[model samples]
Target chain A: MEPLLSCENVSFSYENTAVIKNLSFHVNSGDYLCIVGENGSGKSTLTKGLLGLKAPAEGKIIRGSDLHGNEIGYLPQQNPAQKDFPASVFEVVLSGRLNSRRFRPFYSKEDKKIARENLKKLGIEDLIKRSYRDLSGGQQQRVLLARALCAGSKLLFLDEPVTGLDPIVTEEMYKLILELNRKEKITIIMVSHDIKASVLYATHILHLNFDKSFFGRTEDYIKSPMGKYFFSE
Target chain B: MFNFAEMFQYSFMLRALIGGILISLCAALLGVSLVLKRYSMIGDGLSHVGFGALAIGSAANFSPLEFSIPIVILSAFFLLRISENSKIKGDAAIALISTSALAIGITAASLSGVNTDIDNYLFGSILSLSRSDLVICIIVFIVVMILFILFYNKIFAVTFDESFAKANGTRVGIYNMLIALLTALTIVIGMKLMGTLLISSLIIFPAIISMRICRRFKTVIIMSSIVSVVGFFAGLVISYNRSTPAGASVVLVNLAMLIVFYVIGTVSDKIKAKKFLKQ
Candidate 1:
């Protein structure tokens, strides 16, 4: 079977200066792929490209025949503005079903059921009525994760999900993501700066560097020179 | 002493009340999204554009409402485009457009030598709302209401997070344009009663005041609409009794409501904090 998503010689640039050049990678179903890179390594641009927010300057990104463009669940980095936003957990999660609603003005009963089920899946059912802004950071991330699950069940793209989180919460978050991949067989493409944790949790690793990039199984990546050098640093 | 029965006796007063209340409802509904999106001043900028359009229309011997409607709507789209794609930020873009429009309007009114009642346009004269204007106000109000109800969820999603909304294929641009279009319509109709200067208060105050106490978006929207309508009514009553300007008095009433809501929110927060400490 074809991989879930494949990028062929993809290049992205800002104002004629290339950030990601001739990058190629593929993500298969049930794969936990960690994209590790330093600052300004085009990780953000690549994330935008994969999410269909930005088109590659060269080459193409192909989704699986079964996966529609909007079917990819995306949990973007939390912006400061959203920290003080006024919305209930239920409302935030329910909004993730917007694509499923299509032409319908309001969410249907089935949509509401899916939202509740996702909340329950993430063990955040009790937070349904709570104000989203008032929740602790860990709880907020969980709520957002539940929201992402509501958007798409098969593929998830998380952008630095553990950023700003305490070490314990970060470990918990990583465990939760691992559980989703192992039990639910969900495909996860996580972009992170934490190469240590990324190597520990991810089944596959895509290390993006300014001049050189590597993509392979986690074991092979750990043996690769780039990975060894990164660990040494 | 204010005479409740006699206030409704005059036909012009009734027209003002009906038109003012309807515009207030529409403004408040759209204002919640605008305030949250940090586009609160778009109303003020668009109203200034409407003033310029009205001045040019009057000078050209055209129907002010018909001519200004399309122009103001176009400016709304232009404002959105430049703000998104250009280097100019949102507030700066609004300021640029509004000041230019105001300057052009003032120059055009003076150059035409039509002896227009510019003060009425600047400060608003509620009693000057003609029957035809009132009819237009009613139609716009209905359209705004229906569209708002139909797209409420999409609007909420867009306001809360534009990137997430777009990622889910929510067509964030279209919803944003829809908001801009509705705000333009509301500002134009409201400018006749609230004036170019004070019209944005109708769009800003209600949303901000309701947000003081409402923790949820739905409640914020509902409370905003209620506050706007009640404040408009009370302002009309006070203006009628004291013989004050309708626009200024309505804004004053909204300000008073804001203070009241602020106090209530603070008190409730203190009570909740105390209970938490006790526990």
Candidate 2:
């Protein structure tokens, strides 16, 4: 089968200053690819680049015919600005369907059904009427996940999904992601700073060590020099 | 000393009532996104730009609305671009542009001996809303209302998360420009009722007040419209009855509602906290 996404020597930059250089990888359907890197290593930028939020400063990115950016759900990092957003969980999730129904004045019933299905899947259906800002952190993340699910069909990209969560919540989130990849067979490309967790759950690993990057299947990555170094550390 | 029903007898009062309510609703609708995005002060900046355009239009013997509309729209677009591009950001950019525009307007008004007109524009006499002004307000208000409703979902998406919306194929730039243009038009129309310095209160007060009580976005929007309309009517009535200034009276009513809602929000929040702690 053709790869869902392929990058050929992609370089990302800000203000003409290159931050990521000559990165190449392919994400196949049903692959759980976890990208690990240090702070400011362009891990999040790579996700943005793949979603066409930012154009590559160099080289090309080829997406499969059915895999447009709009069809890829994305869960961005949490920020203070969205904390006070006066929206219900239902409205927030419903907005994720905006891309599907273009030029329509309001959300259709089908869109609401999708939103409700995602909320039920995330086990937050009961909280649908509650305000988004009033929810706890874990609850908010689940609502956001439901929103992202409403946006995409098969591909989901999460940027540091477990960041700022307690250890128990982090573990739960990882388990939830594992269930999505294993049971639902959704294609997952996740960016994470937690190297150990990424190695454990990912089918493939893309490690950006700044000086040298490594990308390979999980089994092969375990025996690689950089992998050995990370293990030893 | 004036009766509320008798005030409607005058044609100018009728014009003021209709024009004020329409402009209030438009301002309230746009205010939600602006307040959310922390760009609430853009209204003030654009109104100052309108004042400057008014002074220039007076000097050039052009209709103030025709002259100021384009200039204010242009300035709104510029503010959007500058806030995004430059390091100055939103509020500072607004301060910079508005102060300069105010200075230019004052100078132009002094030079052209239109300072008295400037005062009328600044303080905003409700009786000054002409028949042509009423007609223009109605047309502009209808266009803005229709466009706002049609693009409601798109605007919500953009306001909630712009980058995410862009990734989902929404043209964030174009929508931002559309919002700016609509806001500029509303500010210009509202100027005849609210004035330059006080006009932003019409845009800001409703949304913030609604947020204090309404938790859901749609509810907040609906409540904001209701608050704005009611406040305008109440302010007009009180001003007419007591012989006070229209713009200031309206803003004071909004202010009073905001405080009332804030107190209610705080008390309810305390109750919620107590319940959660007990659980």
Candidate 3:
């Protein structure tokens, strides 16, 4: 079967300066791909390109025939505006079904069922009626994860899911993500700065560097020169 | 002494009451989204542009409402476009556009020599509402309410998170423009009742005040609508009895409600905190 997502010699630029250059990779179905890079390695720009938020200045990105554009779930980094936003957990999660509803004004019965199931999956069913802003950081992340699941069951893009979380909460979050990838069989493309956790959980690792990039299985990546240096560091 | 039965005796008073309540309801409905999106001042900015458009329309011998609607709508779109792509930023762009429009409106009104009472436009006179104006107000109110109901979910999504909405193929640009368009219509029609200086209060105050006590988006919107209608009606009554400017009275009523809700919100928050500690 063809890969779920493939990018061929993709490049992105901002204000005439190239941020991501000649990047090429493919993600297979049911694969957990961790994109590990340092600050300003164009991780965000690459994610934007893959998500179709920005057009690649060069090359092309192809999505598999079975995958629709709106079926990709995305959990963006938390912004300040949402910190004080007044919304119930149900309303925020229900909004994830906006794509499926299309021109329809309201969510259908099936949409509501899915939202509720996702909330249960994330162990946040009790928070359905709670105010979103009042939740702790860990609880908030779970709510957002459930929301992303409602949007797309096949693929998920999580940007630094454990940032700003305590060590215990971060471990729990990682375990939850691992369960989704291994048991639920969901494809995940997570961007992270934590190389250790990425190596521990990801099936495939894509190490982005300005001069040279590496992409391969987790075992091969462990032995690779760039991986050895970063892993040891 | 204010007579409760005597206030509704005048035909102009009834017209003002109907027009004011409809505009207030529409403004409050759109206000929740606008305030959440941090575009609350868009109403104020667009009303200034409407005032300018009305000045030009009168000078050119055209129906002010017909001519101002399209002009103000175009300005609304322009404001959205520039704020998105330009370096001026949202608040600065609004200030630039609104001030320039106000200056142009004042100049046009002075040069045309058309016996136009500029103060009527500046402060709003409820007694000036005519039967024809009330008819247009009713039509615009229906259109605003229908569109809002049809796109309520989408608006909430866009306001809460533009990037997430766009990623899921929600067409954020179109919804943003839709909001600007509806607000332009509301501001132009409301300008006659609330004046350019005070119309935005009708769009902003009720939303913020209701948010003090309402925790959910639906409840916030519902509460704001109720607050707006009641506040506008009370303001109209006070203005009728005291012979005060309708627009100022309406704003003061809203401001007073804001304080009342603020106290209520604070006290309830303390009570919740105490209960949590006990648990």
Question: CA shift at B246, candidate 2, in angstroms?
Answer: 0.6
* TM-scores of all candidate predictions against the true structure: 0.96, 0.96, 0.95
lDDT of each: 0.91, 0.88, 0.89
Evaluate candidate 2 and give its CAPRI docking class based on DockQ.
medium
Model 1 lDDT at residue A75 = 91
Instruction: Summarize candidate 2's per-residue lDDT along B1-279 as a digit string, tens digits.
Output: 567679899888899999999999999999999889777878889999998898888877898889889999999999888767757677777888888988988888888874577887787889779999999889889988898899988888888888678778889999899999999999998998888889999999999999998999999999999999999999999888889999999999999999999999999999999998999
TM-score of chain B of each: 0.97, 0.96, 0.96
Collision pairs in model 2: none
Native contacts recovered by model 3? 0.84
Q: Which lDDT tens digits does candidate 3 get at residues A1-233? A: 89999999988886788877888889999999999988888898888888888899999999998789789988988877787788999999999998999778989999999999999998899999999879999998898899899999899999899999999999999999999998899999999999999999999998888538888998899999988897686
Question: What fnat does each of the candidate structures reach?
Answer: 0.71, 0.77, 0.84
Docking quality class, candidate 1: medium
Q: Model 1 over residues A6-57: C-alpha lDDT tens digits?
A: 9999999976789988889999999999999889899998998998888999
Tell me which residue pairs clash in candidate 3: none
lDDT of 2 by residue, A1-233 (tens): 89999888888876666778888889999999999988878886787788887889888999988786589888888776787899999999999998898766788889999999999988889999999889878888888889889999599989888878899998999998898889888899999989899999999999975437888898888899988988986
Interface RMSD for candidate 2 relative to the native interface? 1.0
Question: For model 3, what is the alpha-carbon lDDT of residue A204?
Answer: 92
CA displacement after TM-score superposition, residue B224 of candidate 2 (Å): 0.2
